[model samples]
Each structure stands twice: as structure tokens, then as C-alpha cells.
Target: MKKILVIEDEEFVRENILELLDSEGLEVFGAENGRIGVDLAQQQQPDLILCDVMMPELDGYGVLTTLRQDSILATIPFIFLTAKAAKVDFRQGMELGADDYLTKPFTRAELLGAIASRLKKQEAVQEHYNTEIQQAKDRLSYLAHHDSLTELPNRLSLQELFKQVQPQDDNYQEVLAVLFVGLDRFSKINDNLGSDFGDSLLKAVAIRLKACVDDQDIVARINADQFTVILAKRNHKKDAADVAQSILTSISKIFVVAAQEVFITASIGLAFYRRDSIELQQLLSYAKKAMLQAKQQGGNQYQFYTATFHIISVDYLNLETSLRHALEREELVVYYQPQVDLKTGKISGAEALLRWHHPQRGIIKPDKFIPIAEETGLIIPIGEWVLQAACKQTKIWQDAGFHCLRVAVNLSGRQFSQIDLSQKILQILRETGFHPQHIDLELTESMLVSNTEVAIRRLKTLKSLGMQIAVDDFGTGYSSLSYLQEFPFDILKIDRCFVRNITANPHNAAITEAIIQIAKTLELKLIAEGVETEAELNFVCRHNCDLMQGYLFSEPVPPQEFEKLLFSGKNLQFSPKQDHEAKVR
Candidate 1:
């Protein structure tokens, strides 16, 4: 029910008005003076207010002016009930923001009709504003999930699409294929012509590519020079191969971009998974890797991704048993891989990688045992040890003159899930005498997706302590663009799979460049992993990548070797003349 407040100096007028409104089924309030009416309005926040024009300590004009100053009460519909109905009095009330004026001794119909008209108009205005707000929200959501140039579904949209098309039954065999198509040497077009031409070419390609697939099939532009398609149908092995060939042939034809005839070829990779279980991300990764292989084999072809599965042997029991003691015996060691700053071509920081040296096994990679440690809940302790060690090493280097160098240490999923993770790291920092600013913690994308609220809270706590955070192997997991926008990350590390052959293979180059653009747009630091050649270095530098790490600089090495490089003042020898000459001119 609507609420109405009546303010009049005369007891009869106020009481009679309240009784009439009450009989009309409205919750009613009455006050003998304007002062009491203001107090009641503040308390009850009435829908509409009726006041006497000339009476009481505070008259109708004063009350309306005062209430209009309040943000909450400013929009309330107000009507003045007055014995004086002169032209000047009506003008004064209207100028004070009154909704309507009801002369004294008026009919009951006049009072109720004024209130009804004001309330109806107010509701219509509110509905219009609400609709505008909803429309703006929808537009923002669409822009967040789509590519601006081609207006095609991007990585985040692709992830949501996968969820809808996922196989339902666990026991029934399902066949799904992911095809990654990369335009070979496509960057040459941008370099020779311009970005406008390149953008037009990509838009044209998006149109033709969509025409090649059925309505049920999914097609999306995953990167600048790459497109991904999903064939979510049973018995799709042969059909997958045919689709790849069709896309390759379709993309190779000439295109009229900017009224200029342009020709391009695509190298397609087909990865089909036929099993009772499904992993969409894994299939996409395989297709990308296979596309790189196709590009390596001279391009203009399609390659089927093949995998070798290893049978589980009984050796894991002993390995697990040995890992329990590995930490205690000091068999685990930390290695430092230099992260080179592309702007200065100098070592700016190092990522601390953990390694194990078993007496019988010689050396063991982290991938072989990290999963085991995670499964057994051993990663919490080991991860803490690594953080402490990395921090202490960073302090040592800082004392030795590399004052600006920071150390990045990876945090495992198990360690990050702990409730007191931030407290534990803060304690380690205090114990190691290391400043939180000089150490960076790296986390995988999967670790943050499970419990976003918890992850955001923990990340905020760590950030409050002045520590930097990075997202490691970014493209390897299904991280949405909104996720990146929500998380407080200082850096984004491109996965090796996206950085391989970035210079010669358009597939990797396109993904690598797109990641760089995202980092730039978000104002986050970027690090390209696995940049192994001068060509790769040039590719990233030409696009203004912030940092890079790979064998081209130095692999993850023992502390002694890393110290020697630090002492020797070894810096990357590179020149930016080739990349920046045009801009400089």
C-alpha cells in the first residue's frame, strides 16, 4: 500500500485529512505542524507528502526546500494543501518543487486524484531509468566476451560454449574434435601494408570460416591470426579431417581486402578425442601444438595430433616414498632462470624453479613429482620451503648489488588453498629478512577458478603486505577475461605453448601478440616464456613485450652458475634499431 503524510496547523484539518486517506486503504501519517511532519517523513520515508502552505513553525515552502536538499528525499512527490490559492501562492509552491496544489475545502476526490497522478508518473519515470541501466549492462557483458575487430566469440565465450556442449553421459563414448587454424606468414601482410588491411582480412576470414561449418558446429576467433572450431558430434574422426581440409582450402583463396587482392594459406591441426571422458582444454592444447607442427612442415597443410600414453608402472610407490624424505635430506634444490627486460635487454629478475637430485635417479624434473606431492598434501610444506629459500636468495643478491632484482616462486594449488596462506608467507618473509616488494609469487590459472571469493580474499591479503603476484602459464588454462579483470595480478606469463615458433608460425605469433595486447590494456607486466631465438626476441620486442625468459637468455641453472652470471654482470646483447627505426624516423 502507498503511504501518505499530512501536515497542517489546525487539529481538525490534519485529523480529517488523515482519516480520509486511511479510509482509502493507504497507510496514513498525521502531524499538527510542519516540524512534526518532517520528523515523521525522516522516520517512515513516506511515498507522498501533503502539507499546508501557510502555518506552523515550518511552512510548506520551507519544508519542501529542506527535503529537496536530501538525496533520498529529494525525489518524493509533494503536494501542498492551502487555504490561500492565489496565483503568487501557487507559483511559489510550484517553484519550491511541489508536485501539486490542492486548495483548502477541496473535495476528497481532488486530494486523492493529485496523489494518484503524481505516483503514476513517478513510477513510469523509474521504469524508464531501470530499462536504460539494464541495457547498458548487457552491452558491457557482450563486449567483455567478444572480439572487437571481428565481433566473434573470444576465449571467454568459447569456454562458456564448451560447458553447454559438454558430453552428458560418463559411460558412453563421445567423439569431439578441436581444430586450430593458423594463417602462415600472416604478419607479413600487416608489416607490408597496415593494421587496417590486416584487420579487414581477419574480418573477411571470420565470415568465410563460419560459412564452412554447420549451425551446430562452433567457430571462434581465438587470436589475431588464428581460429578455433569445435565438432561436437559422434564418429567425427573422418569428418574432422574433411573439415580441416575445407578450412585450409577456403582460407587460401584470394580476398579483396581494401579493394586489393590478397592471398593467404592456413595450416590446420585436427585433434580428436574419442573416449568416455572429456577434457576440452587438453584437446585445444593438442590442436595448437599440432598446428605448430603443421606450420613447421612448410604450412598450407593439415596435421593430425598424435599422442603416446604411458602405462602406469609400480615404480611410483617407491618414488612417492622417496619424495617424503627428499625434503628432509636436502635432496631438493632451487634453480634460477633469468627474466630479461626487453626494453633494456638486461637481466631484471629471475624465476626460482625447484629441482630434485636423487642419488639413484640423478636428476628429476618437477613435473614427474609435483603432482605426486600435490596428491599426498606434501606441497604445502615444500611450497613454504621454496618461498623461504627464494626470498633469502633474493636478499643475498640484493646485498650483492642487484638491488632491483626480484625472485618469482611458483605456488602450488594445494598451498594456495590453505586458509592461512598469506600469514604463512608473511612469516617466511620475516624469517628470511626479505622485503615483500622484492619477491613475486606465481599462481596457475586453475588454482584461482575453484573458489574465486577465497582466492580474491587471499590475494588481497598478500597484496596488502606489498608482495607482487603473477599468473603463470596463462593460456594453458581456461581463464576468462572477466577473471583477469577481477583478480589483482601484477604480471601475466605467456605459456611456452603459445610462445613456441612465435616468429615463423603465425599461430603462436598471433596468440603471443594477443596476450601482449591484453597485458598492455590491463596495465599488467608481461613475460613471454620459451623465447629461444633471436627471431622470437624480435617478434616480441617489435610488439613491446615487457619481459622474456627462455634458453636464449639462460635456462634454469644452479645457484652457483646464476651467481657467476650476476657477478660477471652478464647482460643480453641486443639492439632495438631493427624494430624501432621506422618509429624513430
Candidate 2:
């Protein structure tokens, strides 16, 4: 039975309405005043409330306002019983949240009709609310199982699918291959290009990846730049290899995103389900290991999971974990390698090299963990720390009477591409009270070549700050000497590869000399790296290399040791001095 509340000041009228509602099969409640009506409404939480206009303690408008303010009783339909039916009186009740109204002497049929109509509409409003709630839940569920960007199955969904694919019978196992495809230098694209462009590219890559597999193959985006494929009924190793190669080719093709053509490559790693393990996580893990191995061996190829890959991957993962904590633990220290002017044999500047002093592992060279840092995007923060530390230390050295001491810090690809990079470096220099003119920022040719316009803009921004910019690792990338005229580079550092055997190897000597000659012709400063022998030193000095840093002069030493060298006035003694009266610094 429906419940109704009757709040009439007159006892006779209240009893009459209560009895009448009872006869109509409604379980009824009665109150003498508006105050009692509000109390009864909250206790009963009734479907509707009937209140009178005139009452001693509280009026009908007051009762309605109280009920409407309550979360529990707010939705109940409320009717005002008022003798006055003027427009102003009706407006007052309605404005106070009165749902419907009844005249002083209302008919039974009219009262019942109003109650029934409101109850029906309330049911409809509740139904609509429930539907909206269900839709929100459905959207959340879809997001949990799918990558929001590509709308591809996510890692969790892939694991669930793995469970369904696993057969119950111990002996009967389907021949399956789990492959993980990783995009090479995907981080570079994300760091250089905007995320919107990178997201568009990933979505395009997803479509191409799906096209590379059959209907039976399940594809998922398990990570930011990693896609996984589960091949069913393909047991042979060669079948998986062929699919991997196809995927590689498809990824390597030019991608047109946002009206721009982008070229990227992929490396794949696959593990046979039965050959590796029946477990899904194990298989995926094995595939990922091989994927890392392929990336370490220089990307754009496929590799099968080998026992050796697991060892290497574990080492990388552990080292990456340690590196993440190394900053907070104060294990990372900046080591300065003295870069000496070949002609004067006096220390010109020092290149700031990062070293990890792990408590358990002793001194860890950068090569062991720098790639891990680069791949994980840890280079940005670590690179910033190095800048701050280098600038502060160089400032200290200058204060100690070494006024001309210059400090050079390398910029990671991610750091170089950041839009606020110049501002950040400028802020650090200001905080450290270091002169921007005394600091040199070194970046690779590959970083500049990625987006020449952006590189030029950023370079000019840094240049405006009075800091020198050098293109490090010069000949290792695809950039030609024309890059010298294209970008605003103040110095070109010869890569260690060519400088290592410049005297012995004819090809290396030719390349090194050509770089030096072009840089000399362009009138840019030159620095030769990896000069470990007297012959290598003589060879670069013969070509008028302005500065050189290697084991021959000094290996990268701790700041304390470098400070000692500075205090002791250690200098390289070399002959065949070249006059630089015509050269501008």
C-alpha cells in the first residue's frame, strides 16, 4: 500500500483525511502542525507529504523548505493545502519546492490523482538516473581493458585472453608464439614532437600492426611503445620470424600523421609458447627480454629468446632500478675530464661526465647505465642535476682564482628537445651564480637533425643566453658538413670512433681530417675526443685541432682530483704550436 501524510491544524480535518486515505488503501500518518509534518516526513521518508497553509508553529512554506533541504526526504512529493488560491499564494508555495497543491476543500478524486501522477514520474526519473550510472560504469570497464589512445586491448586484457587460450588438458597444448614489438627511438619522437603527434603516430602504428597479423592473432598494446601479438596455430619458429619481419617492414614505412610524413623502425622479439613456457607471463617476459636484446644490439631486427638474453635483461633491469634510486642516495657525481688547448698545452676547459658511485658496486661508468637512463627517460632529471652540479662546481673553481675555467655539460636528447630547456639552464646558471659565457652545452648532431626548425629555435634561445653550443659525436650520425651552415653551432667535437685510430687507420684518419678541415673552413671551434696516445695527440694537433680531451691528457676524473690538477697547474707539454692571432674565440 502507498503511504500518505496529512498535516492539518484542525484535528477534525486531519482525522477525516487520514480515515479517507485509509479507506482508499493507503497506510496514512497525521500531524497537527507543519513542524510535526517535517518530523514525520523524515521518519517515514514517505512518497508524498500533505501540508496546510496556516499553522501555529510553522507554515506550509517553512515545512516544504525543511523537507527539500534534507538529502533523504528531499525527493518526496509535497502538496500544500491552502484556502487561498491567489496567484501570489500559489507562487510562494511553488517557489519553496512544493510539488503540487490542493485547495482547502479538495475532492477525493483530485487528491488521489495528484499523488498517483507524481509517483509514476518519480519512477521514470529514477530509471533515467540508473541508466546514466550504468553507462559510466560501462565506459570505465572499457577503459580498463583497452588503451585509450589506440583503442587496442591493454595489458590486463591480454592476460585475461591468455587464460582463455590456455588449454585445460595437460597434454594438449596449442602451438602459439608471443611476440613483443618495440618501436626504435619512439621516445625521441615523443620528446621532439608533441604528444598529440606521437599519439596520432601510435594509433597509425596500431592499425598497421593489426594488418600484419591474421584474424587468429591477438594484438595488444602492452606498453607506451610496445605492442604484443599472440599467434595461434603457428608453431614453427620460421612462421613467427616471417611475421616479425613483416611487422618490421610495415613499421619502417613512412607514416603520414597530421599531414606530416614520419619514418620510424621496429624491433621484434618472439617466444614460442610450448618451446618457452606454457605460462602467459613467462612467455611475455621472455619475449620482452629478447626485445631488449634486439634494442641493445642496435634496433630494427628480430631476436628469439636465448638464455643469454635473460641474463642481460635482468642485469639491465636491476641497473635501471638502482639508477632511479641513485639520485636520491647521492650516488651520482659529476666527473670533469680536462680538455686542454693543444697549442698552449694549458687546461682550457673540462667536460662534465656523470659517474655512479654505487655503495655496493663501487664506481659504475656511465656506459653501463646511461643507455638505460636514456631509454627510460631518466636522463632528463639526471641531466638537469648534472647541469646544476657542474655550474655550481665551475663557479667555485672560478672563485678559487681559476677565473677562466670553463665547464662543458652534455645534453641528453630528451633534455635538448624540451621547450623550456634554455630557460631551465638559464635558471640553473643564475642560481649557481655561474657566467653563461663560461659554460658550454654539448648535444649530438642527431638531436639537431631530428627537427631542424625546432633545433634552430632552441639553439638560438640558448645562444641568446651567452652559452656556447657544440655538436658532440659529430660524424657518428647522418648529418653532413652542410649541417654546419644549416644550424648555429659554435663547436664540432670529433667522435671517439674516428679519433681513436686517426693515426693508424687510413679511413678513420681521412674522415677525421675531413671533419677538421670542413670545421676549420667554416671557422668553427674543434675538439678531438678519445686522444689516448701521443701519436693520436700529434695527429689531431697536426690538423690544428683547437682542444682535445682523452686519457692521453686525463681520463675523466672526480671533481676533487680535477681540482688538484687545477691547483697543481698540471698542463700537457706539446710542440708545434699554431698561431691563433687571426682566429676569434
What does the lDDT read for residue 79 in candidate 2?
85
- Best by the TM-score measure: 1
How does each model score on lDDT?
A: 0.83, 0.84
TM-scores for every predicted model: 0.56, 0.53
Error of 2 at 420 (Å): 45
Kindly list the per-residue Cα lDDT of model 1 for residues 211-239, writing each as its tens digit: 88888788888887999998877465777
RMSD of each: 13.2, 24.9
Candidate 1 local lDDT, residue 264: 92
How much does candidate 1 score in TM-score?
Answer: 0.56
| Candidate 1 Cα errors over 4 Å, as ranges | 32-39, 53-62, 83-96, 171-174, 234-236, 274-277, 308-418, 421-585
